[model samples]
Target chain A: MIDNLLFLAAPITVSIILAGILSYLGNHILTRGIIFVDIAVAQIAALGTMIGLLLGFAEESANVKMISYIFTIAVISIFALTKFKKQVISQEAIIGIIYCLALGTAMLLAERIPGGSNFISKTITGNLLWVTWKSVLSCLIMFILIGIIHVIFRRHFIKISDSKNGLPYSLWKTRAYELLFYITFSMVIVKAVPIGGVFFVFTLLIAPAAAATLFTDSWKKRLIWSWIIGITGAIAGMYLSFTMNISNAPAIVTLLGLIVFLFAFIKLATKRIVSHNLSKEKGS
Target chain B: MTGLEFMFAPLVASLLLIFITVYFGIHVIEREIIFIDIALAQIAALGSAVSLVIKNISGEAAGHDHDSRTLLAYLFCVGAAFLFTILKNKKIRIPLEAVIGIAYAVATTSAVIILDKGAGSDVHIHDMLTGSILWVTWPQIIRLSVVVVLTGGFHYIFRERFRKVTLSYHGVDTGLKNPKLWDFIFYMTFGIVIVEAVNIGGILTIFAFLIIPSSISALFAKRWTTRILIGFLVGGISTLLGLYLSWNMDIPCSPAIILFLGAGLLVAVGLRAINKLFSHQRQSR
Candidate 1:
């Protein structure tokens, strides 16, 4: 029983940490009008894994898998850079291209390589029940490190994110601000890749951040709310997955979606109720 | 024949198809209905799966062949596209996204089941995902070219009406109110996108060709005509480079092409940042 608990503990911790980091990065993405970049990046990561499998890399080679993800990030970053001029093209189109290209590449590669079908299938439709200890530990350490860094550099991060407001008069300057933004984004892609396997990462990252935005105007409050919602969704999803005997990633995504929906509904209801009360009071 | 002839044929054909897809994709992106392409592609894929099952059950040897199967798949895709459009108008009030998502999910699962049943080879399914541009036949090329020309012609004729309809939603009301025309244009675009998409590979190819190059071009070009021209250039370059890289390195073409586009975006961003920096430096100086 303890062994089973220990086994489950790693995945749960990783999921929560991932949820937190993704939520933070997702907010920045939304503000930049490049929200769909997450989806594109994640899908590209999956495609990379598919390519790894196609290239005769064993499923056990986590390092090779990581390499593929990096490749994906590189690809997505390049596409993002080139399409910087067109207002009409939009971020969503770039994301659409990423999705298509990744999936298509994975399919083509799978057809050629041995054991490619199995690799392709598993990568595309991930199974969370097979979470290993190594992945969990790496995720936990990365998450903690990121969390500490975020705490230390919170002000700087916020300033860069709101660069449109101009540089803040702080101990640090413009170069520092730019460095922090790039690092944070890179960390987000790296950490998110392993946890959600592309598709779920975007939802985990974006949904909580988006939900938090609806409730808070302050950056600090929004970040805190986003983290809280993300952790809550992760825990709930894991528990649900454990009880339901389903895949963990999908379960977490579904939970996050539900939470977003619920928040939206409650927000709508509260606004209506408050307005109704104000009108009644005025009438009296 | 010659290596150049063999190479240029597929490249030219793909370029024509990519052009058509990009134009329609731009409109789709502007409307914020990107998922419609994905959903329709999945529906078409589902139609292919159903066709495969029917052929298997009928024990039809000819129908099971590659050429025949592809033809059948195309027919089914066209049929599904029409059916989907009709269903959208039936007052069921189903959100287009939801319908497309559900259909895609169902189709994917069905494909899995059909493959498991040993009805069709896995290679066939893979073909549906990543198209082989090197193998595009002459007839297919002609078909795609005709579709591109027709779609472009239609867009040109209705350019004023389209601009009016799109802009009129902003409350200035461009007096070009014709609900039927809107429906006709959208359906035509959707139909052409779906058909051309299946011919290329599936929704992914259609989507990449449709949206990526144009979106990237938008970053550099200000004018609409210039944007389109640049987009076509980007698309054409990516296709050629992607094919070359894939052939040389023995990697998948689609991702390579996408990665190439991504590199372009990064370069653009870098240039913009440099421009800003230079302007700032000049002001200080």
Candidate 2:
């Protein structure tokens, strides 16, 4: 039992860290009008997977190696688009388009490849039970790299997120913030793609961060709470799925929903209780 | 008659559905309820999934087997749509997006589990995702055409009233004052859009035929007539192009159509920017 728990440490730790990064990124992206970027990136990554399957890169082939390359390219494309000022379309609209196109391409490609239909299905839905030791290691390494970059560029990120107020400051450090933001977002897409597939990654990237924003005003607190909720949700979800023999991705999403629901309820109840207590105090 | 012959009904049904959806989507855009479409789409998806589960429990195959099951699915969808509209009108404290997302997630999961256990491998969930537009027949198409015509006629008859309600803040007050008239128009439009969208995979249809084109047209055209005409042109061209692309490339039609619209928006933006740049440079010179 102890050995089993130890074996699970890597996924748990990686999930916690990845969740934090995703949540932070999601919140900032939502505010920036690029809320659909997460979904688009995930879909693009899945498209890449379909391309891999078509090119005979099955479980045994070099297809797995290409996941990172495809993910990186997709992330860079999105980052570059978001950086443009005279964008004719909203980022959300562009992202939505990219998502559909990528998924369509994947479907078309899957129809051509032998036994590719199964791969397409798995890519969309995902199978957490099949996660290998290699996947776990990859996730950990990516998580550490992202966490380090985030720490190193925390000040710059904060400035960018506060661009409205940091207009003067940004004039001096303009490229720095953009570069950091792009790199962090790229890392997020890369790490999230393989682990959760598209759907779970999209949800994890946005929902927890959005939930955390409701409870805290400060970026620091928001990031902290977002990370806590994300990790707890992942671990709890995985455990429940394991016991219940259900798919981990959907279970994790359901867990996130439950967490958000609980938080909202608690906040509402607390407000009511506080008002009641204040009224009684005044009466006394 | 071959399997191809059988596909005619769905194909025609989907085309009619597309027309009605595009018309309603114009209103959805004008009202700035873009996210509301997403919410309704998710609700419809959930409703369909639940209906599928119900059908499976009764020992029926998931698709195209029984007309009654399909009817049940539409009923469920309309019911869900009504509930969503009511909740939205009431201004419930819950964030509509969250509620819709959760409902969508639950519905999708339930649908998958039920289908997986019941039908095994022959049934594809992608059928639900992509829709069966290829299978629509002539009679089905005719039925859809009638709905579109009637709905369009009704909108024309009440055009001024709707414009007032939509364009003015006072419209809501007027609506409250004459509840029955406004309610009738509102429900008619709502029910028509829901029915048509259900025929075309809900949000995909609305997004492609209505929201994207209307938004793009609104960006360039100041007058409502120009906006509507431009929207119709963009939508019709994109739909034709999307269908052709899907047929040739063996891709899904709906997403292809949306991508075309997105590309159109990009081109429009590019043109506006170039025009602005040239004017600025000319002025400077």
Candidate 3:
């Protein structure tokens, strides 16, 4: 068992790193109320990689990165344009449309390429067991860089996401900050999607933060709780994956999802118990 | 068979899809639970995956057990709908839409985990997304039609109740008797339709069929009947055009349908924008 864990050490470490940073970003996304934006952005970036592969570029080549960057730019532009003041339609509607479009287009392109279905399947669940220590090092470096940028502009990012801040939704400065945020977000997704796959990335990005929200409203406390929940879930998921002989990405996601569901139930039970005590005290 | 004859089954399948999906789409939009269809579809897919996993462990011939998988898928969809109904009254701090979105993510990943235990996970996952509309046969279309007619009859009988429940989203309670009961019925029927729709059209195509036609019709019409009519018109045209393109160009049918619906949505949005601009100018005058 120890030898098996040692063999699995690199993937476990990468998952831990992913859970930490992705949990932070998930908090931001939950606050923003655009929950599926990560899924949309990740799928579109994968589509860009598909485009590169269609043109005969290798998976992790510079040309693939460039194509993904262009797709990111296009998506950012769409988000900015669709952030209207009067809002003829909901932003969620637009996001849904874009997600389907990207997915459909990717499927079309995949049909023409060799091993395209396998490529997509990998993008969805990822190949976490095959990740090497060298790629883990690169992933860590990229996350640190993005983390620093978010830290430097923490206030602006938080304020813009706060819906009741009384600021107009369509300001030029808001657009610029939104663009900055999405650019960095896409950068993380470009890195994370390859490592964790779309499903695992989304789970890490939403589940921990959601669980944290059940216990507190303060952002700092939520971040701390989110990190704790995420790290714990990651370790448990890795253990489960190793012992059960299953794949990593889906196992981690299922564990994290169960954790969030369990937290919600715990919150409900406590609330009920406290209410019951209060009623008894009133009767006395 | 000739090319046009070959395209006929898919065309009937797409039109039959509009018959059920567009109506639920109106209710979905009215309630603004836009992602529910996709979420429910994912849950349904998860259901099939679980059954497949069970079959694998039981050491059976899993490939031939289509009926059990379909039955399990229906159970999952209705069960999710029941869960959503219960959760709505619990009034958790998070938005229901957000909860639905979370369910979507988790269910999708769970399916991934289960399907991985079986062979051909890649092809199965890809088919769940894009679907194989081009290869649909007459038997499938006929089976779908029977369910469609039954669901349509149920809705027609309870039309006023369903409308009342949907309008209650805007706080207009027109004597809704047992709102929870009505809500379940609506969702149960909705879930049933989604299981069949997802089987035929995949996740993306069905979503477009659900949202785009109703959204476009909503841009022009006010009354429920008018909106349904407009939705039918838009969807019918898009299906014909999309299937024609798929037949001639040999692209996948589901995506082609989605792209054409997307194009229709764009045109509708543009027309709405132009209409707004003219009205604003007139107000200024």
Candidate 4:
């Protein structure tokens, strides 16, 4: 039992690290109301990986990594360029279009390459149980570095996401900042996709942040609650995966989904009770 | 079958797919729930995966039972549509789009887990993603048409109510009664169309069919009939180009079509830009 539990340490630790940066970015994405952007970028990065494989590059090689990074950077630049204020077409539509085009192209490539179906499935669902300690440590260092960058630009990032206020910087500077956020965000996605798969990355990014939003209004408290919820969900998911003999990533995602639902339910129940009491007080 | 005979079913299937998907896509864009089709597709995929697992447990090969599997998939999509209706409340703090995104993630991961228990998870996953548009059959085309006609008829009968509910998003109060009821109807119909389209075109092609044409139409027109007309022209042209390219180059039909649609979008964007530039020049004179 101890050995079995020890075997889970790397995956759990990787989940914790991912949950950290993902929850932070999740707050930003949710605030922006472009919630699908992460998955879209993740798909673009996966398409990049497919291109690397098609070029005969090894999956884990630095060259393939660079190729995916380049792909995501190019796509992010397009997203930034397409950011229009007048909103003739919704940004969500643009993101969806990019996602489908990328996915379709990837599917096309996957058809030709040997073992391509296996490779695409691995990228989509991930193999969290087989995560190594070396990858975990490397991801930790990279996430910490990105976390520092976000910390340094927190005010600017936060202000830009505040829809009520005009941008604090000039149009060019704001675009630059937006570019910075997308770059850092895609960097994390390109890394996280290999570890947790696209679905896991999306769940880690959205679930806890969404749950935290249900209970709190302030950013700080929301961040705190998000981390707490994210960590709890990760640990609980790992535990369930071990006991139930299920795959790790889906277990984590399903638990996070449940946690969000539970939070939403609690919020609804409490509001109902409070309103009930208010009606009684008014009658008195 | 030789030549166009081989391509006929897929061509008809794609046209039928465009027929309903483009209509739904316009509504999706109008409502700003752009990713909703993908979300519903994922849910339907999960439902199908569940049926596969059920068949496996019952000591039968998983892929044979089409009727129950499709039914289950439709049921899952409708359930999700119902949930989306509730989550569309204005009082909810989290954006409905976020909720839909979360639903997509959860549904996909759950499908992965369920399919993992089966032997042919990879093939199933690939089929769910890319579909077999080239190998589409006349029967499938017939089924898809029945669904399209039924859904189109439903929308036509209550077009006014459905229009008002979506317009409500822009703060336009047409004073429609029980907008939630109409909203549920709209999403349920949308969900049904997606499941059928996904079966024929795969998720990616169905998405392309739904989004690309409608989006291109939005570039030039505002009225529903005009927009859908342009959408059909754009979708038809891209489908023809894609099928021809796939036939000539021996590539997968669905993704090839999707790429062509994407190219069309690029061309449309360029045209819109050029139009804007010429108008600006005219204004300056």
Candidate 3 structure quality by residue, lDDT tens digits, A1-284: 68887888998899899988999988888877677787778778878888888888887799988987797778767785666544445566667778777887887888988887665565665668778999999999998998999999988888877763344445777778878888888788778887777777888888888888777888899999999989898888888877787776777778887776666767777878999999999999
Candidate 2 residues lying further than 4 Å off, grouped into runs, are A1-14, A51-64, A67-79, A82-88, A116-120, A158-183, A242-245, A261-284, B1-18, B23-42, B52-103, B110-125, B146-195, B201-206, B222-224, B242-263
For candidate 1 chain A, the 10 contiguous residues with the lowest summed lDDT are A80-89
Model 1 segments beyond 4 Å from truth? Answer: A1-10, A39-127, A132-137, A162-176, A214-229, A239-245, A258-284, B2-13, B25-129, B137-154, B164-195, B202-207, B237-285
Q: After superposition, how far is residue A109 of candidate 4 from its true place, in Å?
A: 2.6
Quick one: best lDDT, which candidate?
4
lDDT of 3 at B6: 83
The predicted structure with the larger lDDT, 2 or 3, is 3
Q: How many clashes (backbone atoms < 3 Å, residues ≥3 apart in a chain or on different chains) does model 3 have?
A: 0
Name the candidate that leads on TM-score.
4
Could you tell me which 10 consecutive residues in candidate 3 chain A have the lowest summed lDDT?
Answer: A161-170
Error of 3 at A29 (Å): 1.7
Models sorted by TM-score, best on top: 4, 3, 2, 1
Per-residue lDDT of model 1, residues B1-285, tens digit only: 475577776788768777776666556655445666655565556566667777778987644366555565556556545544543332322223333333343354345444453212242233455566667788877777777777778878877776555454333467777744564566556665565745664445656776676666655665667767877887788778877887777776666776676666567657766988999999999
Q: What class would a CAPRI assessor give candidate 4's docking? A: medium
lDDT for A118 (candidate 1): 56
After superposition, the stretches of candidate 3 with alpha carbons farther than 4 Å from their true spots are A1-6, A55-59, A164-170, A270-284, B1-5, B30-32, B56-63, B112-124, B167-177, B221-223
Give the whole-model CA lDDT for all candidates, comma-separated: 0.61, 0.59, 0.80, 0.84
DockQ of 4: 0.63
lDDT of 1 by residue, A1-284 (tens): 68867778877877776777788877776554455565455556666776666566776598666776567656755553433222345445555665665665666666676666554444334434556777777766776787788788877666655654334544245445544554456556645555455446766666777678767768778889989988988888788767766556656765675566556557656777998999999999
